[model samples]
Target: MALPTLHYLSHFEPSGYGLSAIAMVRALRNAGYPVRWTPLKRVGYDQVAVMSWPQALTEASHWLRDDESLSDLPALAVVAAVVPLAGAAGFTIAHVAPELLAAVFATAAAESAHFERVAYTTWESDALPVHWLRCFDLCHRLVVPSRFNQAVFAGDLRRPVQVVPHVRRHRTNEFSAPDLVELRSTLDIAPDEFIFYSINQFEPRKNYRALIAAFVQAFSSADKVVLVIKTGSIGWADGPFFEPVQVRQHLQQMLLRMRREIKSDLPKICLIDAANLGGRRMDALHAMGDCYVSLTHGEGFGMGACEAACAGNPVLMTGWGGQLDFLGGDYPGNLPYTLEAAPVWPPERPSFWPSQRWAACSIDGAVQAMQGVVASPDEFRRLALERAESIHMQLSEPSVAAAWATVFAAS
Candidate 1:
């Protein structure tokens, strides 16, 4: 019998799912599996000698290798072959939704073979959406980033569920002394100013508006504090796409209701479009901040919070969902929260929404947490340091990689 090859399908980009796919590939390869990568969208499998699709990733050129333009990957070895459906021999791992899997399924089915198929996904609701349950039928096993997600999704699943974390190793500070100096200067922020940073798309579930409300309410304009947000995505901006001036204007307008009571001493706020930034730059951004905040309704796994903590920035987050797996049972760095009914995809929209329950954080509690942190920097730093150590230990590279490879190997 031939060796069972590992065929992985996912985007080699920077979003949460994409990052998980990249990390899993690395781990599996490190575990010495014969792995093949299939890019979700267009990919150049050039004959230029590359072993992995993640090797093709370059933010400078829209997910292409630095040395190669996205011509066809001339080498057959670089591109994963569509396995035969009737008698296919290898296992297939898909990081895409079922609707998106139609093409992959068809191509793989064209050949006469059958092999194991596994699916990995991320979700934030208390229960799996009805639309996605059917997709699980196609997979032999389900792998999620958090146990919370596993519970929410496993209610009616046919296969076993497993938790594999998305982990990042400790990074060498990407910014030099001069780079830090220039960065603060460029953002019009002074070294003496205490900075609170948050990065996310302006979506309803992300609840950025709540963070803004709590922020402006917590501190005054006269205070030497700044809320630096790297966010975008407007009326039609699904996520990354940003209209900076317009987006900021929209946020200021959203604050109008509470503005009257803000006493007119609005906190100094800076908004930047989180577009076209590389990994190193992202690391620098996280490292430069005094605290990182992400106030979301729920998360399958709070990737941003994990990254911020790993970067050593104190995090003020909504204490709920999959994050609990590593944030500690009590969620030490998190703010106080309340369990609320599930919300639709767009919190603003009411009628056409999925049924998924999540937590609604108390803005007043957030205000208190913010005040408490600023009042004693040392205390918050200690808390952040403790969390950093705990999270890293739980999600060390070798352990996480081995866990991922185990799941792949099992199938």
Candidate 2:
């Protein structure tokens, strides 16, 4: 049979959604399935082309409403709609949004006959909205990245769901000693110092402040440990709902206070803003980290953590979401000495969603975790390398390709 043509949609510019779309498309294409990626402009102010008030209002109204013509894309055997489905497009594989299932269902309803399935990655119970049942009723199948996600949607939506763990490519060869030495020197990091890195956007939900606090606290006595944070620059306030500047300012203040209050010889801090890195440099940045950590309050899928793990680094992530499925219990060697609690989100904060409660992790917990890694640097390094090797088999490109082929065939 001729390879099925799949069109993956992404909205944000090179964001988590965009990366996921690219990874999925690349996997499918490599597997001999024809895949095309299309970047759909996010609506509202950030839209590529400026629009008049009337035009913007009209487009918003149409999005809030529905467009039946979206289903008319010919040769499109499947439409893999990432997170937020752009205003009700008619596509066969309507990858419904886990958070916005109702809206996706309404959109998909316009061409119920045209689409055969809906896919989503549900990491938490609350990730899938209550209306998911209604949405699932309209879908012939549901695709999830993990069994945890599958259970969440299957039990709630009362529909059969398939589990396809996120794909990752593992680099088998270890970095040369010279490469490691150069990387450490370039970052002004000591060869003996233990490094804990977190690569995430500077979003409130990422709980970056807690991570920073934890690092400062954990390395209070140690001058041989460093916490390197890689994140994107925060933008101006978009509306009452999204204020990136306010959040960034709050985090900056927190960091300053921590620096003053925490008496660490290492002083524990480095910020690698994503805005500063591009192309090959970005890959090098990720490759240099000794270990990757994420204490996200919520995640559709812990793609960053996975990528880090693939790069032969131990991942210190919240014990939730799709990470649980991908990491599994087979993490080689003993567990890193600490697994911190999730951070708490303050009330009245826009980042706090109604469905989410309790802090993802506290600064104290993060500090303890970092300290543990520093104290036993050799153990952590060995475990990280071993864990990478053990999981490499599962996330291999060929394995992921096979899984994608199965999903496509089923669809």
Candidate 3:
């Protein structure tokens, strides 16, 4: 039988989406689906293009309006305005921006006959707009990664959405204890000290500052615990994508400020640039860490958290987004921790920052959790191994491939 041809579209390059897109494409391909990854250029920032169709149009309109050549003229403005309408006509559409609802409605009306099945993945409550409801009305299905996401969509937008847990690419080999030791030695991490690692891009949304603050507060007195942060540099306006220079500078400043605020010497914090770690080195680093920590303010899917868990490291993350879906409901597994149930809003949104409405464990809380694990190293190791085994079974590549097969067949 011929393999089904599935097209995956995005605006940003593949690497930017981190591992979620990587897992999806890998799974689909392994399932005998011929995957076509199309990175759209005729749009604004690539992030929008990766989203559902309506988002792409909305972004494109904003991009055009921002350009001096297109904004002033009435005719050009009208032409620029029609792009989302064209997109709605050609593809499955979901509106993520409230301002673009009218455009989405017009586009949906124009393209109602073209698409067999239109879908939207509501990663959060903010993702659902009134126009998204209109699109949902026209669409055959709505895709969501978690029950929480689906519930928000249903309650807020009053739309029925299907849940498909975020798929992950499986690791090839389990790291041996000896391998872990060697990796620790290579990184110059102490043999006896417990290591907590976090790998993420240096984005404000990642909440790295809070993680650093928490680490300083929690582990500064205990020289036996090391916090190894592996992150690339943050991007600057009109700067190269994924540049590490700016991020390195920022970290230096933050560390200095943190030292002053905490009134303590700098703790053992190692910042690793992803560019410095090749495949073997990356594997070794993952193997070396005793635990993986991610206190992201928000995430569509916590790929790093899942990857860490898969690598036989216990994951310490905020209860948000798809992380909850991966960890299951009864998470932390009776560990001395209180998991908070809350949604993290984007910092860009109004009344988001400084609002303690989200269920993020405070730095003190995370420190307490980390301290419990550190004090009982053997217990932590046992839990880590168990979590790794569970992840291996639950997110096995073959299982994900099977799920993709079903999705493709339906598509």
Candidate 4:
């Protein structure tokens, strides 16, 4: 008998969900699995052109065509995508939003072929949404990227929840050397000053407000260091850009108010307002920077912090969330957070639990971490180097392939 065909259904867009889906399919096929692929779209597929991820070293790439997967690597196999019926013992695992999970199960109810979960990594929030709690009954297993997320989901889920983390690759590896001159000229970052980098989409959960407030409080214009923030007005995995006008206005107004109240004006903060930085240029930007920081409220896997930590930057993030998967339980760790009623986010996000309370990192804690990087640069470097080495080993292709193979085989 032929090996059962693997039907890989996923969201194919420019966001984290789409990237994670690409990484999974690539890792599995790269591991030598004969897997087939399809798009898990909810609407019209004609108008939009799904982007091929791993955009250029210096730019994000998009092309309109008939192809589904982008990598030059030839596919191992192709298979039919059919719905699976209950008790069919089929295999499949997917990462979908709360609203999509029920629809996914409904698709599986009759055919059962699509019902079998082969195990895939999906995101979980700081709190599980109440309305979707009932959907858990159909799932036998759930794979999340971080322990913090596991705990949050487990509070309501009866199924086994495992932590697989992200299979993120570093773009910094492709660039042979730093392009400091071009980088400085582009961002207006001076040679003498130390650079502190914060790269995130301009959203409420990232805690950009808290980070900027802390940066202004921690250092002044006289200080030779500057905070360089690379941000875009995009929300999360749903993949639509928020209005840059409103995002910019809110940030500027808040910073201005804080500056006025503090009686200081130091144009030391620089913002790269676009989201489409090329991967290589982004890597070089990281290389030129002295440090990276994220005062995020919470994370499903803290991909940004992990990327920075892997790239050998001294990373400062909220002590909680998915970063803990790599940052572990030690110093150079959590920015120290307290669970509080979840703040109302921009219109894009609607799935969090205020009663359960998400993390709100302390401003003092952020100051301590930011200042420590300056005060004892050598110590933080040592720690960052350690994190870089460890994560490099674990997230490497072979290791990730082996992990995925084990899960798929067991499934």
Q: Best lDDT goes to which candidate?
A: 1
Ranked candidates, highest TM-score first? 1, 4, 2, 3
* Candidate 4 local lDDT, 145-178, one digit each (tens): 6777778777777566766667776233244444
Question: For model 1, how does the per-residue alpha-carbon lDDT over 264-331 read when each residue is reduced to its tens digit?
Answer: 86877887776644455566678788998878888888877888887777888888878888777665
After TM-score superposition, the amount by which residue 336's alpha carbon in candidate 3 deviates from its true location, in angstroms, is 10
TM-score of each model, in listed order = 0.82, 0.71, 0.68, 0.81
Off by over 4 Å in 1: 1-4, 42-89, 107-113, 169-173, 235-246, 346-354, 408-411
Over all chains combined, what TM-score does candidate 3 have?
Answer: 0.68
Top of the candidates by TM-score: 1
Better of 1 and 3 by TM-score: 1
Give the Cα RMSD of candidate 1: 5.9
Which 10 consecutive residues of model 2 have the lowest summed lDDT? 66-75
Ten contiguous residues with the weakest lDDT in model 4: 49-58
Candidate 3: pairs in clash: 10-50, 11-46, 11-49, 11-50, 12-46
Ranking of predictions according to lDDT: 1, 4, 3, 2
Off by over 4 Å in 4: 1-5, 40-60, 63-90, 103-115, 118-126, 170-173, 176-178, 234-245, 344-349, 409-411
